[model samples]
Target: MFVENLGIVLALTGAVLSALLAGIGSAIGVSRAGKAAAGVCTDQPEQFAKVLILQLLPGTQGIYGLLVAFIALSRIGLLGGGEIAALTISEGILYLLACLPMAFVGYFSAVAQGNTSVASMAIVVKQPTQAGKAMIFPAMVETYAILALLISILVVNAI
Candidate 1:
C-alpha cells in the first residue's frame, strides 16, 4: 500500500508546497508593505486606497499558487470527491516538477514585489501624482508569477 500510494504522496507534496510556500511569501510581503502603508497613512490617511492597492499586489501570487494547485488536484481526481487517479512514480515526479516553478517563483517574486511596493509607497508619500507609476513597479514583478502560473498549468495539464 505504501508503494501504491507513494505517487499520491509525492503529488500531494507538490500541491502542498505550492500552496504553502506561496501563501507564506504573500503573507510576509503583505505584512511588510502593510507596515509601510500604515506609516504613510499615519500622516496621510487619504492615501489608504492607493497604498492598499500596492499592498495587495504581492498577494496575487498566493492566489495563482492556489489556482495551479486546484488545477492539479482536480486533474488528479483529488478534488470533487473522486477517487485519486493512480499515478506512476514518473508521472508523480512530473507533477512535483511542474509545481516547483510556481512554488519557487511565486515565493521569490512576492518578496521582491513587497520590497518594490514599500519603495513605491515612498513615492506616494512625496509625489502622490505618480501612484499609477508606483503600481507599475510592483506589477512588473507579477509578470514572473504569471509565467510560473502558465508553466505549472501547462505542465500539470499535459501530465
Candidate 2:
C-alpha cells in the first residue's frame, strides 16, 4: 500500500536533505573562501598554505552532514545491508526529524564559517603573522556544526 511505502520515502528524503543542504552550503562557503584566498595569493603567492587552510575551514560542515547521511542510510538499509527494515510512519518521521538539525545547522554554519574565513583571509593579507588569530574566528563557527552532528548521530542511533 502507498502508506507502507511512505516510510521509505520519508527516510530517503531525510538522507537526501542531509547530503543536499549541507553540500550546497559547503560549496557556497568554499567558493566564497576560495575567492578570498585567490585575492590574497595574487599579492603574495608564498602565503598559499595559510589561505588554503582558511578556505577549507568551512568545508567541515559538509563532511559532518555526509557522515550523518551515511549513518542514516546504513540504518535504513539503504547502504549495504542485505535486508532493509520496514520502518513505520512514526519511525520514518523520527528519522527525518533526526536529520533536520544537521541539515539546517550545517547549512547555516558552513556559510557563516565561510564568511568568517573570508574576513580572516583579509586579515592574513594585511598582517600575515596574525593568521593564527584569524583562523580562530571561523573555527568558532564549527562548534555548532559539531553539536548538530552529535545530535543527529544520537537521534539516528536511538531510532
- Which predicted model would earn the best TM-score? 1
lDDT tens digits by residue: candidate 2, 1-159: 989888878987887898888888999999999999999889899989999999999998889889999999999998885688899988899999999999999999999999999999878988999999999999999999999999999999999
* C-alpha lDDT values of all predictions: 0.92, 0.92
lDDT measured at residue 120 in model 2 versus the true structure, 0 to 100: 92
Error of 1 at 31 (Å): 0.6
lDDT, candidate 1, equals 0.92
Task: Mark the regions of model 1 whose C-alpha exceeds 4 Å error after superposition.
Answer: none
